[model samples]
Target: MKRKYTAAAAVTVVATLSLAACSGGSSDQPSATADNKPVTLTMSTWNLANSPEFKTLADGFHAAHPNVTIELKDYDAAQYATLLTADLAAGTAPDILTMKNVTDMVTFASGGQLQDVSDVKLQSGIKGAASYKLDGKQYAIPYRIDGNVIYYNKDLFKAAGVPDPDGSWTWDDYTAAAEKLKTGLKTAGSAALPAYLHGWNALVQNFATAQVPASALKGDFGYMKPYYEQALKMQDGGLQLPFATVTANKTTYQAEFGKQQAAMEIMGTWYVATLLQQQAQGAADKFAWGMAPVPQRTSKTAGTSNTPITYGDPTGFAINVKTDQAKTAAAKQFLAYAESQEAALTLAKIGITPALTDDAVVKVYFGQSGIPSDDLTKFAWAKQKIDPQNPPSPKTATLNTVLSAMHSAIMTGSESIDKAISDAEAQYKNQVG
Candidate 1:
C-alpha cells in the first residue's frame, strides 16, 4: 500500500524503469523442468528477513522440492520498489518478487516485466486471487491479504479510564475515546500521545475510504475535509503528535506504540508481523497490545453505505518474465506450494492472513495461546467485502504525494486547509498532466 513514487520526479523515474521492463521479452513458452538438477529461485519482498513466514516459505518450498532452493531477499517497504527497479535494469532481478499491491503488479505486467501465470490454476474462492489479473489474463499469484485495523494499548486504555472498543463502534465513538484518552494521558503526567497516525493516507483518507470508494487520482478531496480539520483539532488538543515534530523525528507508528509513547494506532494488518516479531524479541510486552476495527462511518456516502468498512487489497508475488526455462518452471512450482492452504496456515500462525482467507484457518491463527484472545486479526476476516471499485490509478502515486503535502502544510500552520486543497488540486493536475 506504500506508494513511494508519489513525487513527480519519482513518477518520471518509475516511467523510465517501466520502459526498461517493457524491453524484456514476453515468452509465453512453457518453462521446462529438471527435477533432478539443483535450481535456486530468489524472491524479493518487503517482509523483514527475520520474519518466520519467509522461513516457512523457504523451508516449505525446499522440503517439498529437494533440488530447489528459495532465497528471500528482503527490503524495507519504502525502498523496496525503487531498489528492485535498479536490480531489474541491471539484469539482476530476482526470479520472483512481491509487489506492494495489484498496482505494482499491473504496472510490471503492462511493461512485460512479469511472467504470465495463466497456466497455473489458482485456488478458487480465495479472497484476493484475481487481484493480479488484467484483461482476463493472470500475471501474478495473490499470496496474502492486508487491511486496516486499530491497534490499541490495553494498559493505556485501562489507565485512561476509557472503555475498550467493540466490533460495532463508529467515528463518533472514536472521537470520544480519543478525547478521553488524551485527558488520561495528561492525568498520567505523560507527554506521550493518545493516537498516532502515520503514512499519507492513513492519517486523513481512511475515514473517507471506509465511507466510500475513493482514490487519489479520481477521489473527491472534499470528503476528506472533515478528518483534515479534525487533525488540526487533535494536534491542538495534544491528542495527536504535530506533523512538524513527526517529520523532524521521523518517528514511526511501530516505534511510538512499542515505546509506550502512544495509546493507539490505526494501521494495516501487515503490522501483525511487526508486533509479533517485537513480542518475540520482548520489545512490546511491557504494555499489553490488542487490536480492534477502525471506527465505522455512521452515514453512507457516494457508492457506499456505512458499515465497518476499511481499506485494503490482496498483495502477492509475481515472477520475472525473463526467467530462464528451468528457473521459470521451478519458480512456478514454488509459487503454487507457497500460496497453498498449508502455507496460508503457516502465515496465520504468526498473525498474518493469506489471500486464501479460510475462516477455520483464521480462527486457529487467532486462537493461538500466546496472542491476546481478542486480537484484531479475526475482525479482518469478518464478513465484509474489500474496496473493489478503487482500482489502481496510473497517477495515484504522484497525486498521493500532492495530498500528503497538503495535509502537512495545514498541520504545520503553513497553509489554510482550503487553500491547501486548492493548491493540491492544482499540483495534482500539473504533476499528473
Candidate 2:
C-alpha cells in the first residue's frame, strides 16, 4: 500500500527549499520566522504507490509554505518495519516515521526513538488521538479509522428470499440468512477470510457479542478466553462448507468479495469504496450491496455493543531522535501539514476515513462519490467497542498461528470445543510468556 510522489511535486518542494536556503544564509539556524530561511523535511510513509491523492497533498503543502521542502518516500508494508528498524539502528531514520498502533508507539517511545507531540496542535487535527496516547505522552496521530461491518450483496439476498440486513439483525438472523444464501451460492456456503484469526475479525466479533462489554477486556488479562470461544463458534459454523467448495485462494478479503464469490464479507471502510469502483466499472451490475452494523447475539440489544465503534490501527509520524534540530522542526511542520484538512480530504477521496474531525471536508469528498456518508461517522462510534485494554498487538501473530492449528483440528473433528479452547489457552500462555 505504498504510493509515490509525482515528479512535479518533488520539483516544487526542491525549489521551495532552495529559495529558503538562499535567504537564510545558513542551515544551522532555526528555519521558522516571519522572514528568512526555509526548512527542509523528510517524511516516510506507507501507501504512496503512484497515487494521485498523495501528489495533490504534497503539492498543496508546497503552496502553503513557500520556504519549506518536504520529501516523501514510500515503503512496502512487508518491508516497512524492517527498513524502519534498520534506519533507527543505523542512526539514519527519516525525520518522521509512521507507527502501526499505540503498541508500536509505546515500544518506540520507550526505546527513545520518537518525539513527544504532547504540546503540538497536531492532536486537534487527528481523530481518535486518545487511543494512541500512553500514560500522558502522545506518540502518534491517527489519520483514519477502520472497522469491520457486514457487507452483503442485495441481489443475492433478494434472490435467496432472505431479509435485508439492518441495524437490528441478530446473530441467529445472520446465520439463517447465510443458510438461505448458501442454497444458491456457487460454493456450498459462505466464507470467512482465514486472516480473521489475527485479532481484527475476532475482535470485531467479540465487540458485537452479547456476552460482555468489550471494554472489560482492556487491562484484564483473562478476558481473552471468551473472545476465543466466540471466534471458535464462528469458525466452526463457517467450516461446514466443503473444503473444495469454499473459496480462500485470494490473498485479500476484498478480492474475494469483489469477485462476488462470497455472499457476504466482513471488512472495513476501504472495501466500501472498492465496491463502488467495481460498480462503476460494471463489474457488479448483477449485485446490489449495502453495509450494516455487524450482527449481534440478539436483536433487542443489537446496538448495545457500542454503536459506531471501529477498530483502527493508526500509523503515526515520529521523529528519529538522532535527526538534527533543524530537520526535526522541518519534519514537525511536514507532519502538521499532512494532518491538515487539505491533506486529510485527499486521503478521504481514496476511501481512507481521515483521522481529522473536519466533517465538512469528509462530506465534500464522500458526498459526490455516492459513498454512505454516515458509514464513516458510524464507524467512529463503532471504534468505542474496541477493547483498548486488549487492543491487538504483535503478540497477536503468535496467538493466531496457534489458533489456526487448533481450528484445523476442530474442523477435522479431532478435538472437542472444550479441548480446543484448553489447548489454545495453553499454547497462548506459553507463547505470550
List, in order, the clash count of every candidate structure.
Answer: 1, 22
Model 2 C-alpha lDDT per residue in residues 240-272, reported as the tens digit of each score: 233223334424455556666566765655566
TM-score against truth, every candidate = 0.80, 0.73
lDDT (tens digit, per residue) of candidate 1 on 1-433? 4323222111101000111221121222222255458877777755443445666666655555556666666666666677777777778888888777566776677777888888777876565665677767787776677667778888888887888776566666677788999898789776767888774545466556556546556534767777777677777877878788888888777788888888888876677666777777888656677877676666332111323577667766778988998888888876776677767876787767677767667676777655566534355344445553235545645765777787777778898878887888888887767
Mind sharing the TM-score for model 2? 0.73
Pairs of residues clashing in candidate 1: 6-397
Q: What's the lDDT for residue 295 in model 1?
A: 67
Candidate 1: Cα lDDT at 207: 58
Q: How many residue pairs of model 2 clash at the backbone?
A: 22
